[model samples]
Target chain A: MKKSVILSILSVFLITIFLGGCGSKDQTTLNVYNWGDYIDSSVIKQFEKETGIKVNYDTFATNEEMYVKINKGNASYDIAIPSDYMIEKMIKEGLVEKIDFNNIPNYQYIEDRFKNLEFDPTNEYSVPYMWGTLGILYNKKMVDEPVDSWDILWNPKYEKQILMLDSQRDSLAVALKKLNYSMNSTNDAELEAAKNALIEQRPLVLAYVGDEVKDKMIGEEAALAVVWGGDAVTMHRENPDLEYVIPKEGTNLFVDSIVIPSTAKHKAEAEKFIDFLCRTDIAFKNTDYIGYSTPHMEARKQLDPELANSPIAYPEPEDLENAEIFIDLGTYIEQYNRVWTEIKSH
Target chain B: MNKKWISAPYLVWMVIFIVVPLFLVGFYGITVRTDTGFVFSLEPLQRCFEPTYLKVLGRSVLLAAISTVICLILGYPIAMILTSKDFSDKNIYLMLFVIPMWMNFLLRTYAWLTLLEKNGLINVLLQKIGLNPIHILYTNQAVVLGMVYNFLPFMVLPIYSVLKKLDSSLIEAAQDLGANGFQTFIKVIFPLSIPGVVSGITMVFMPAVTTFVISRLLGGGHYYLIGNLIEEQFLSVGNWHFGSALSIFLMIIILISIFITSHYETDKEGSVGLW
Candidate 1:
């Protein structure tokens, strides 16, 4: 029995040594949580190969899902990407960690315009990854009239041919803008009017879509879809018949930023990954692949000149004069939830 | 040898997976977070009785019932045909019916979306045939069609198995007692197949009542069912207390359905249980 036990122990030790040699014992692992389809996965592989750190990546469909998981504190995630208002909420709720820019030397590559935004005014918690605006993606073959206003979404002529965003804030922002109200208006009467407008538009809507909007648009399933500028760019690439435009009433401008959650297991590795992502070449590669507007000055110079000069990618200041960014709604968020649920139930 | 100990692992799994999670749901359903700690509160449960929620509940039940009844009407004849003495290659027929179910349920439902879209396959074919293209993708009828298509197999299989085992002696006796084809079916085959019908109803109704994907994908997210409400509470709104309360309400509905089904089952076969 003793000899058999010694043989088994010897085999186990040998296996362990072989495995340890295959994957170095000192290699650290990082867990990243971000929005679905938000990244070029090849960058993750590059990061892994360069740093010898294994990455466990997961994606969320909405900010609420990421917030709930972080709020529960059940799972430890090293890094997370959330939009502007959601980043503010996470900072307020103490669910995120403050970044130490000393470790991220590439932070210098970020443009001055994106440095001190409303979401992270002090530049303490988050780093801007991508910025986009909401707009309409219309098929030229299907839409006969000018598509300059959000009112066309409510037009009866396009009944069952209109696709709206499924997101609460995004959808509500559309309704709010169509009524000539601020996208972030907290006035009860304004919110009520927005709610009524959505209810009146519901019958004409083909569907309230999420990421599927891209596939449906590419498939020519609908005439018009309310989509983000990034998705519109990607979809328009696949179907040249499609055109994107920010309505005359204006729309929400959003910035999604990267942050480390408080429950991060590898804070140092997470910082390294963030810094790697901010590198000029890496930033350019990611922006080129994801088709989102980059906030890195050096990265923007490397982008396709045609794309960089396009108004949709670099809109003139006067064109976006009425554009508004979402701020943390805090307790008033519940009121939005109530209005949304009421609209849906109606 | 005592076999009771062999069941210990199963019992442990049940307690851990089923009982504990249900207890936790009940706990969350009745409690609200306070400054100090959680406190007992009925507000969440009471919120379920609101007019908006009640309307969602009514629509869920009404849609599920319509789908279940349609399944019965369509499935009964199919099951009868499959079990008939004149039918040949019975296994092949049953296999053909179940083959569609072998694919992923979500994929099948998604296929229906592409087929029924305004410019999808069905509409294109209709245009070629000189028929007006019907608007059927995002309506309540489309949701029912999805449910009926997906759950028809559940309704047919149970009834088919029961009808297959039916004693021919009873039917012959009914025929000998001066009964016509319809009379024999009403008096004999239908009465004896109650168990299968009951189980079929339970199977079809349970899934139909709680389906969120069909309603969301095919109904275009305009219509809110109870399942959709529960999903919104947990996923989008992050209202665990309210979500738990809604879940408990759905559980109660399922329990009541099972009770009513088993009650009639026992009335017919005293010791028989619901599957």
Candidate 2:
């Protein structure tokens, strides 16, 4: 009886909060949806405190979930953060609206290099959030030499000590990049090569993981991993002995960007929030907390000196040039799926 | 049972929570339109058995089968102990098994990763305890362990309820016929408990097949079950048509198998079904 009563109270409480969040259509409210643990939570509260606009925040684990959720409904979201490849796909599918550049005067705060890229070529639709290369975060204390490239990971010496990403795209992209192939390669033969590499590499994998690799990598549980850049930064700080290296043969350089969906009801508020987030102070806070590289130019200058010098957070200019950005592969998805199937099955 | 206005609300709550979401799931699944104002096509249901797709189906069935058998073997004894009434601290035992489940499913699976990885807790403990550490996390063993661990409660509770409801007199009657303990169990308790066993099996197998998180987390992309494939198609590929086809086919396969099982079991028992 008590349990049921408690549940009733909880339900009422939740409903009240949810209803309160659903503000008057005339009043300003901004809904920002991002990947879980993507930014500094404190900054969000600060934004709401200062701006007087209610913020509805939610999180998803992957790009696909964000994409599907936004496109599948009467979207409650005003702003969403999706990675480069997904942003490209969103643009192609017409799921996102072009940003009104005037509402976002702070767009000039972004770095020069990130200005015009494949996903949203003219910065018309998105603002870069966090950027990083997918690569091995290795323990210097355990391994011999500076972990130069992807081949070093495939080396037999690292067997059972190496972790791979659980993601199909990131894992396969590493293999694809190793073979001097584009991470976005839709060519069946190229995908097949990546598949074969994974099949061979699978037996040697210690484990495939996501953010928890940051914990395991720093805890000295695994010597190395194919990890996301933000996760690598977290790992590196945990143990200075750990280092993140983009492979010599090239690796994935990607960014998560904030965009407004076409179905968004509160576009003006969303743009306000985006412009607020782009402000150097807030952007810097997000970067400092998340430990991933921010694309915001002036915000980056505010990062701690030690963190600013970390190569994982800011890969060398040459390394950035060699790195490939993943773009949407529309119809050839079947072939990638097909190759991924064989790799996993075998 | 509480009050006039308040009591009326629970009935409304159950329907809204249970009936409404289910209605939405069914409604959107079959008849929803695309974002572009395009009417959703049955095209999502078309490619259910492309050879590649069939392989995923076969894999889901196999994974579920293995998990169900393991759950059966592991769960029965545990459930028996809990319902035995002879066992002290039965609630404690149940809680030990259930506390892990109460935690986030994803977190528990990841906890397995921390234990099973090469230099993880199990290995470190093994080595510290002067035994060789084994690679256990990414293997099929880890995947099955995670599944059985996650779904074991589903298997346990039903069987425990059935066991608790069992009449001691029935087993004694069989034993008075000069039957051994095993024979008495086989003849009376086993048959009587079939309903719970079947319910447990269905509960375990159905969701076990559909679980994407465990296979990806513990199987380490080394395994590709049907759920993962469906996820890949819909999310990664953005090929909604193909994904829809796969989902519809999976639903059909589930529906048909369930139909056949329900009919066959009911006919065999002249009444009982998994439901």
Top candidate when judged by DockQ against the true structure: 1
The fraction of correct interface contacts reproduced by each prediction comes to: 0.72, 0.51
Provide DockQ values for all models, in the order shown: 0.63, 0.43
Question: What total of clashing residue pairs does each candidate reach?
Answer: 0, 3
Docking class of 2: acceptable
Chain A TM-score of model 2 versus the true structure?
0.90
Compared with the true structure, all predictions reach lDDT values of: 0.88, 0.78
Give candidate 2 regions above 4 Å deviation. Answer: A1-27, B1-46, B85-104, B251-275
> Tens digits of per-residue lDDT for model 1 on B29-60?
99998889899999889999999888899899
**Candidate 2 chain A lowest-lDDT run of ten:** A1-10
Alpha-carbon error at A2 in model 1, in Å?
57
TM-score of chain B of each: 0.95, 0.82
Writing each residue's lDDT as its tens digit, candidate 2 over A1-346 gives: 1222233355457646866787456546677788777778788779878877777676666676777778765567888999998999989989899999799988889887887788888778988888988878788888987787788778888787888876668888888888999888878788888888888887677776655666677778778888877777887777888877877888888888999988888888888889988998999999998888899989888888887877778888898877888888886765776677677666
